[model samples]
Target chain A: MEFIQQVINGLAQGGIYSLIAIGWTTVYGVVGVMNWTHGEVYMLGAFCGFFLFTRLHLPFLAGLLISMVAGSLIAMAIDQFGYKPLRKIGMPRMAGFITALGLSTLLRYSSTALFTPDPQAYPANLLSYKLLTLFHINGKAITVSSLHLMIFLGTLVIMAALELFIRKTLTGKAMLAASQDMSTLELMGANPEKLIKITFAISGALGAAAGVFVGTIYAINTMMGSLAGLKGWSVAILGGVGNMTGSMLGGLLLGIAESLTAGFVSTGYKDAIGFIIMILVLLVKPTGLKGYSAEEKV
Target chain B: MLEVNDLHVYYGNIHALKGLSLHVAEGEIVSLIGANGAGKTTLLTAIMNQVPRAQGSVSFLGRPTAGMTTPMIVRSGMTMVPEGRRIFPRCSVLDNLLLGAYARKDKKSVRRDLEDIFTSYPRLAERRRQIAGTLSGGEQQMLSISRALMSRPRLMLLDEPSMGLSPIIVEQVFATIKTINEGGTTVLLVEQNANQALRVSHRGYVMETGEVVLEDSSANLMQNAQVKEAYLGS
Candidate 1:
């Protein structure tokens, strides 16, 4: 019963991680740049939702919608101002890495300045938590909350839609190809710049959605972005740097592992367990489970 | 028509293309033949704007191609089948073909071109659903050419289409290039296979260490003593 209970507890957290992980993976896959500010995007999004819902008295869905749009625009603006000029001059790749770190620092500290260093909670009555009993094992009932179900379902639907888009749509297919070989994609007449911007937009939107989840289930604080962003990048690496499906699964795996560690062992070991498992996975399968095989391209 | 005047390309300080000049008139099959590392691939890449030009001008159809992006170059009806048949390995054959038309806005004509390509290369039609990486070398080359054709290009740049293929496959590839040229698309081919290239092309330019050393009609170049001794293995 404890095991089943831990699994239920892990799913929503896993859902949020996967949303954040998608942001990291998609940007890395397309631009080959580590978006250190990714978690900040999520943090900003959560704050956006928090403000919209709390101050403006908007509906929950409306708040989410605003976050998605605002997050996407913010990400695109970063690309435009920060990376586009560098790309124009054929910037060395290390410069991009530094740019990401610099951007992350700037966003985090500025956000702290804007929102203050205190944690902000969602409205207590924002979401009604209806409990549902799954089944009784050994006279212990396994229960799930409405909020948890919403996160899980939302993650499932979003991931499914993303997968379909990549496989079926022309622009999505082009981005997948661009991820493989941007130069060849250029010869095929797809603009790498446009595709990358689109990638950032999608990634920021996912991060924003994850931000809303974290803000709702836990609490929003200025300090949340840096550590959460680091974890998101780790999840991306643990899955496979460029594989979207692997990141989703990796997120779930990390979530369950952390929950189990916190439940069965000590809360102190929870974060440590995720890194240990990721290192073990890397040791065994460096490419991650569903990673692209480095087969001959020609 | 394409004209590249006094082109210079540099790989760091290596200076891969040194004052190279070449041209391809409309409806002509032109081949650039050279030894390995003789700047043949670099020239094609420069024309497509893949590499920064140190000094040069590439004019296609009377317009300067200097500032155009590769996709913009393709949209203007000039496309290249890059060396080693750089097909999108994970994409389906159909998807590869669709992407070839990425710059063009004519959806109806693009679909019509797809059918024409399928009818022309039945092998490609059979494997249209298969991942491009799984195709055999010859089939992959064919798919590459077909994909370039889907752009409805007035001129196609083919780089080493015969690389790693058996002689039989090479013959078929050259035959297809010839046929495509006959069907009215101008061809600018780069090849190390001097014999086949000179035989198929209407004209040929011989390059040695980043410079075009010889240029003439293919028939005359085929019989030239220097060409026969150095390239044709007389």
Candidate 2:
């Protein structure tokens, strides 16, 4: 019963991790940049949600929508100002990586200075904290919070919509092709730059949604992005870098592992569990769970 | 028609194309034959504005394409079947074909053209749902060519379409190139297979070290002594 309870507890947090990892992988796959600032984008989104809820008193759904739009704009601005110039000058790959790191630092500190380093909480009544009882295993009832159910279901809907978009839409298919070869996409008469911007925008929206979810569950702080961003990268690596499905699965696995560690083992070791599994998975498969070896370019 | 005049392209310090000049008239199969590192690929990319031109001017259909982006060039009715068949390996064959028509806005004609392609190449139609990477090299080449054709290009640039194909497949590919030309799409073919390229082309240019060493009617170029000894292996 306790194990089942722990699993249930981990799922909502896992959903948030999945969103962040998907954002990271999508940016890496399409733009070929690590996008270290993504976590900061998530932080900014959390702050956006905070402002919307506390100041404007907008409803939760409206806050989520506004946060997502804000996240996309911020991400697109990062690409436009931070990375696009590097691309135009035909800079090396390392230059882009360094730029991402620098931008991440700048954004993190700027937010820290702007919002102050203190943690802020979402409204206690912003979401109903009603716990629904499922079944009694022994004498103890297994229960889930309504918020947790909402977060998990919301992630499922978003992922399903994303999958459908990739499969059914021309622009989405073009994005898939761009991941394969950007130059050839240009040969097909699709502007790769436009596709790249859209990719960043989508990635930003996902990250922001995850941020808002996390903010609702926990206190929001400028420092929150640092750890969350690293965990997201770890999830991306665990799932197989650049593979969307892998990131999704990896995020859930890490979340469950962490929750179980906290339940059965030391809670102090919960954060270490994800990285240890990632290292082990790398040692075994190198390509993560679903990552295929890159085919030699013909 | 495509016109390249004194086009100079550099890869960092390496002078890939040094003030080279070439042109393809409308309704003609013009072949540019060269050895490896002789700037054949650079010339094609430069024509499409994929590479920075150090000094040059490319005029397509009598308009200067000085600052046009590659996709803009493609949208203006020219596309390339790039070297080594750079098809989206993970995508389905049908998706690949659909992406080839990405820039086209006329949905009805695009659908009709897709049907036309399927009718012409039953093999592609058969494997439309299959992942492209699983296809044979010959099928991949065909898909690449068909992908270029999907753009409804007035001029098609082919870069070494026979690079890794078997001799029989190469022959079939050349035949398809001829068929495409007969269908009224002008072709700018770059090949190391000089003999076969000359056979299929209306005119041929021999490139050496980033400059045009010879240009003439295909029959005369085929009969030239230096061309016979250097490229034909006769």
Candidate 3:
């Protein structure tokens, strides 16, 4: 019952991790570049949500939507100006990864400079705090707040919609094929540049939405992105580097593991639990659980 | 119709396609046959704009495609069944086929053409739901060809379609290539399998280390003593 309670507590945060993991997984999948600044993008998104709702007096949902739009544009600009030029020069992929790391640092420090490194809170008066009693497990009434329900349900809805888009639409299927072999996808008449833009856009939008969800739940700060981004990438690696299904599972697993560790063991060890499980899984299977077979004919 | 004139493509300091030239007329099965490293693939990649050409002109339907990108070239109605049958191994067969038509605007007609493709390759229809990588090499090749065909291209470029296939499957692939040509899609195929490539193609260009050493009717080339010694075997 405590385990179940821990799982419930983890679900909201787990959903957030999985949402972020999908973003990191996608950008890596399409162009095979890790957008290192992905965490900063998440942070900026939180800031975007923070300002849009709190400053502009917009509704929470509306601010989240605008943040997605803004996040997507920001990511597209990063690709257009930063990575696309590197591609044109025919630089090695390692160069792109390095550039991304540099960009991550740039974005993080810039946000800190701009936002003054001060933590900000979402205005609580916007929404009333309401809790729902789910059930009584071992005489302890297990309950979830409206915000907790929102995060889990929101993540599920987004994921389900994304799955349907990938499975049912031509552009979506092209994304899957592009991830496998981008040149081949291009040779087949699909513009990889366009698909790449869409990939980053989708990734950024999710990151921003996750950002807003977090802001609503807890205070937001510039430093928050580092841990969130680390968790997202950890989840992505834990599931599989480029595998969508693996990333999702990896996020939930990390969340629950962290929660359970904090609940049963030392709270100080919660942060270490994710890395430990990732290492253990890597030892057992080099590819994450849902990762595809890496077969190349020489 | 497609034309490549005085083509020169380089991989760093190495000149892969050195002053090579070839042309394929409408409704012709043109094969570029050579040994490995003879620049057969490089010539095709240059034509498809996948590789940058140091100096040359590649025109499709009389439009100069110099500096054009792959998707742009493909959108202009030329698609390549690239070397290694680079099928989306993780994708389903149907999805792979659909990706071929990613640029087409005629949404309703795409459905009709898809049915047409399934009719031509019944084996593909049988495995439409199966993951592409799980299929045999020959099926993957078929999917690669069909995937290119889904674009409804005016011209198709196939690179080494028979490399690593069984003799019987090679026969089927060549026959399919012939059928594709007969159905009104011109073909510019690059292959190291000189004999079969020559047999199936209407005209053959023999490349010897980045130059077209011979260009003649396939039957004529098959009879050439030099060709017989170097490729066909006595």
Candidate 4:
């Protein structure tokens, strides 16, 4: 019963990880560059949502929508000004990674300076906090909250929509092509610059949405992005760096594993569970659960 | 319909193309044959506007494309099937072909052209949903050609399509090149397979150390003694 309850809680939290992991994975897939400040983007999004809710008195849903739009624009700006020029100059891959890391630190520090490095709680009543009993396992009862249910469902919808878009749309097809070989994709008449820009925008929007969800559920803070970003990175590695579905599964699995370990074992070791599983997965199957074959001919 | 005059492309300090010149008339298959380091690939890349040309003019359909980008050159109806069959490995065969028509706005016509590609290469149609990287070398070559064709080009540049295929597959690929030419697409075919390329091409140019050492009708060049001794291995 305890395990089942832990699973439910983990699934809810894991759903947030899934959204973030997907964002990271998508950008990595198309741009082949880690947007280091991605977590900061997430932090900025929550702050954006919080400002709208508190100052402008916008509805929670409206605030989320606005955050996504703002996040996407922010992401586009980073790609256009930050990364694109570097790529045009034929910079090494490591340079892009380093730039991303530098950007991430810069965003985090700037947010800390602006937001005072403290957690800010949003106004309550944006979501119902009513607890619902899912079922009972042993003599103990298994319970869940409406907020958890909403978060999980929202994640599923977004992932499903993204999957459909990639599989069905021409632009999505182009994105997949770009991931494999950008120069070849360009030779085929696709504008890699345009596709890369859109990829960053979508990744940013997803990160923002994850932030907004966290704000409504927990509290908003600049430092929150670092923790969430670390979790998102773990989720990406756990699922397979370039694989979308893998990240989603990895997120859920990591969440449940952490929750169970915290509930059954020591609470101090909650963070250890994710890294432990990640190390084990790397040792056993280096590609993660759904990573594709990487034996591409050079 | 494609002409490159006095082309000179530099890769940093290395002069990759040193005063290279070539032409492919409409509905013709012209081959640029040379050994490794002879600048065959660089010439095509320079003509496609992928590599910067220091001194030259690339005229396609009587319009100058000397300083245009690769995508712009492609959009202008001249596409290159670059060396090494650089297909998008993770993409499906169908998506690879669809991206070939990326610059065009005619959605319905693009779909129709995709079907036409399927008709041209039935093997590609069979593996339409399979990832392109998993395909055999010959099939990948066919996909590269089909992808170039999807752009609906007046002039097609193929950079060593038969570089690493089985002899039978190479024969099939060269045959298909002939058929593609017969279907009204002009070709600028580059190859180290001098005998086979010279057999199918209307005119041929022999390159040595980034310079055009010889240019003549395919029949005349094939019969040339030095061409046979060095390239054809007679």
Q: How much native contact recovery, as a fraction, does model 2 achieve?
A: 0.90
Clashing pairs in 1: none
- Encode model 1's per-residue lDDT on B167-186: one tens digit a residue: 99999999999999999999
User: What DockQ would candidate 3 receive versus the native complex?
Assistant: 0.89
lDDT of each residue in A1-298, candidate 1, tens digit only: 8998998889888888888998899888888788888989989999998898889988777888789889999899889988888888775688987998899889989999999999998887777788989889999999999888887888888788888999888898888888778898898788899999999999988989889878778889987988789888888888888889889998998888888889999999987887888788889887776677643222
Per-residue accuracy of model 2 over A21-111 as CA lDDT, tens digit each: 9999889888888899999999999999999999999999999999999999999999999999988987468899899999999999999
In candidate 4, what are the lDDT values of residues B30-143, reduced to their tens digit? 998999999998888778777777997889998999667778878888888989998887788998888888888999999999998898789999999999989999999999
Candidate 1 regions exceeding 4 Å error are A294-298
Query: Candidate 2 or 4, higher lDDT?
Result: 2
Compared with the true structure, all predictions reach lDDT values of 0.90, 0.93, 0.89, 0.86
Write down the DockQ of candidate 2: 0.89
Candidates ranked, most accurate by lDDT first:
2, 1, 3, 4
Question: What is the per-residue lDDT of model 2 for residues B107-151, given as tens digits with 9 covering 90 to 100?
Answer: 899999999989998999999999999999999999999999999
Question: How many residue pairs collide in each prediction?
Answer: 0, 0, 0, 1
- How would you order the candidates by DockQ, starting with the best? 2, 3, 1, 4
- Cα miss at B157, model 3 (Å)? 1.2
Query: Candidate 3 chain A vs. true chain A: TM-score?
Result: 0.96
Error of 4 at B135 (Å): 2.3
